[model samples]
Target: MNNYPFGSQAPKSFPAYPKTEFDLESGTAIKRTRKPKNSPFHPLRMIKSFGNRFHHFFKLHPLMGLFLALCFVLALAMILSLYGTQYGVQSGGYVKSDMGFDDYPFSKLQNLVMVAGHSIYTSSSCGKIEKEDSWFLESYQKNPGQAATFVTHIHEGIEIVARDDSALLLFSGGETRRDAGPRSEAQSYWAVADSKGWFGKEESVKWRALTEEHARDSFENLLFSVCRFRELTGTYPQNITFVMENRVGALEKLASDQGEKLTDVM
Candidate 1:
């Protein structure tokens, strides 16, 4: 999937931008003059007022959806035709690792450190990263220092991992905001850390860091990161620490709920 944000410039994770209205607005299409929103003949208000009727456009356009489904089926068929499905998943649950599941090097780590992400960095401009305008913020997140706090968490997670040889640090957050394009909060944090060279602890922390990108809420951040940690390490962490600045009570509650003692509260 194309998980990078819009624009020609993006993180190295994805090489090419995908199709979208943003592309049209970015001059990929022929430039054309359009009426301003404040114009008297603006039609969006009326269309939006239709509510469910407006949404019926999808129901009204079934052919396109059918074509998409057909394309997906064809793509799956093509892959199956080529690969032959010899390694297809079986119905039974996972077998014992014999000794241990060590395919991923993270299997050696025994502790987990998660940094819950709050926002994504949306700026293609290098200068605007520290600015509030560069993020897709909710009403509560419009404050000036909010963006900086997120950076602090990223740095703090790296520092924690650097200090603990057994710890595997995870940047935990999902693609929660549609307005922020396709970037996940976890990916955004990791990218920022990469851009900053892991805040001068690159060699010590880079290998320990990973991302849990499917979590969308506070509890999910902890739960999903634990599942990811177990997947990587083949065993649940003995201790889990969170690095969200000024937030400890929630993490403590979640840790207790997950049946782990919070040894160090920060």
Candidate 2:
């Protein structure tokens, strides 16, 4: 018994490690730990990965992406072009009248009756102007009625013309509304006058009644009508009568500044 080298005591045994499992048929080791759960930024990571993948896709399909981009640009350009044309028409784009300055019959007219337009009439027939709805109702609330005031303006204009047979009557306005299309306020007033037969002086006033369809405001109404009178008659009016509800002081100042004579028609 004492023949052993370490004969005094028996050797202590060490603890045994657990055996790693493996597939017996394939001889592959099994996974011991599960993959860590994705972090809160997993979606961002996935988007980055997708972007890289798409980058590769674009590299492989460059022609398709370029075509799609070109198509988008063209569609945007078309939309802008259409919008620009529509806006141009609504904002008083160039329009030629059937009657030119050479066609004006009264070349020696020196007096002018300028009526400023306030609203666009909806009706096509001038006879129905009284029944037509105007663009703005608030501006006409202080008057008897929109249509009544409009008729009164026409009457006043024609009365001035009837009083003096040498005066040229001009209605001034521009296309001011998008929904109203390209119809000018000046045209509306002239149509109403025509429908009313120049308020009983059709014989004397019809030939002299004209329109300045490019004026956008009160100042333009005064200034443009003068210019139009010159263009038609080849001379500036010796006396000017402005028919409008407001802006009399401004018109007077404008006339004074421009060294033009304006007669207040009460």
Candidate 3:
């Protein structure tokens, strides 16, 4: 009988199995060389690789990518809207109080034309005064003809200022009504004047026209506008011509107390 090892003789015709080499000096088996298995969950490298793959997919299918991007944006906008209601946000023209009043350029102007706001007017879609409501129904019924008076006052103030280049026209009133939503009577009058194009004197008077949006009554209208005049021009107005609907004796007393002259022109 052959004396060779039985298992070793059976493998001569078959492929020879590769043997692992060892370092004789260190006595450690050398590992077989292999290409690493691509792992999908590598912490540092997975994100970058996934981004690259996504970019490639988008490049291949652009229309689907655009639609997905738009959908994501819309979802984000909806989420923001849900948070927006928790905070109250109002929109309108903001009145700036800190206008560098000390550095006002029109300090030489000493003449003033001030118009008092009496009522808030909202003409109907038909453009008739009879269909409008002026803040309160009782007040509107008491003086249903005040719209023409308001327009006349606005035009007269504009004409006075247009005749004199050195005069500044000021509209004075406050947000007195709660239902008006912080809309000032002064701003309302200024809007009416603006809509009417300053009654054909826009070029001469528009630049000088401004609003004092914090006077509750006629005395405040006169007193606050005097302060506003000083703030705007850096000096008190030398000659104040008030264009108001009614004569206010308190205005005369205020002018006397301030050692200033007050003139009423209808």
Candidate 4:
């Protein structure tokens, strides 16, 4: 009966929460939502976060990574090669080879050989011909058996080698004049040279009168003398002194360029 007395009373009520909807019609359409945070250990996050770290991991660990690195290197090398081939290099620059010899050193040079040339002597065996036939003929005839030319040149070379005990003198030429025989022109002049002597040093002068008999032109003078120089010294001559008349600037320049190109082709 007591329970029935409260029939008109209502049951206990629960708390209600307000709705959180946006009102687009009222200009409040935007709403904020929290982003899902990335894990510090995830694969995508690791790749995006570290550049070199990911690259190094790929490089050292797997065959595919090593192959890719090698491919990249090869591509870079090819690009550089193409660039160098296009531009090449400038002219007249000194190129040093790994095993190149030093130039002839005049001061430290021992066993020095100076070859003073005369067109008459070089062409003597060919017999007399037109003035135009010999390159040095006109100059030789003008100077005419001056002996002073070779004498003066020899003196200079002697003075250069006087202090060094190892030096030797080399006289080079052939019998080019019609009056001359096949006998070496170097020997003929050197005999006259032996009698006159070198100022007070005739002993020094007589001891070093070696000869080379095959030079026909200035080019031959240099080339043949160099061969002779090499043969006597066991090694090539350390220094070669030349005494001649006129413009030799072109001679050496052409010889060096053509020689290098020809050598490369071979």
Best by lDDT: 1
RMSD of 2: 15.7
User: Which pairs of residues collide in candidate 2?
Assistant: none
lDDT of 3 by residue, 99-191 (tens): 455568676678989999876654423244333354322354366565677778888999999988899999988887666666787887788
Model 2, 92-131: lDDT tens digits are 6743334445575677788999989887777745555655
Q: What is the lDDT, from 0 to 100, of the residue 95 in candidate 4? A: 37
Give each model's clash number. Answer: 0, 0, 0, 6
Query: Which residue runs of candidate 4 sit more than 4 Å off their true CA positions?
Result: 1-109, 119-140, 143-147, 254-266
Clashing residue pairs in candidate 3, if any? Answer: none
lDDT of all predictions:
0.79, 0.79, 0.78, 0.54
Which should have the higher TM-score, number 1 or number 3? 1
RMSD per candidate (Å) reads 30.0, 15.7, 16.7, 21.0
Model 2 collision count: 0
Model 2 bad stretches (over 4 Å): 1-105, 132-144
- Per-residue lDDT tens digits for candidate 1, residues 109-218, read 99989898888889885455677888888999999888877777787788888899999999999999998888999988898899888889999889889999999877
Q: Identify the candidate with maximal TM-score.
A: 1
> Tens digit of lDDT per residue, candidate 4, span 16-112?
5324455658845446777999857688776677867757789678788788779999999999987765553435553332222344222222454
Better of 1 and 2 by lDDT: 1
What order do candidates take by TM-score, descending? 1, 3, 2, 4
Comparing 2 and 4 by lDDT, which wins?
2
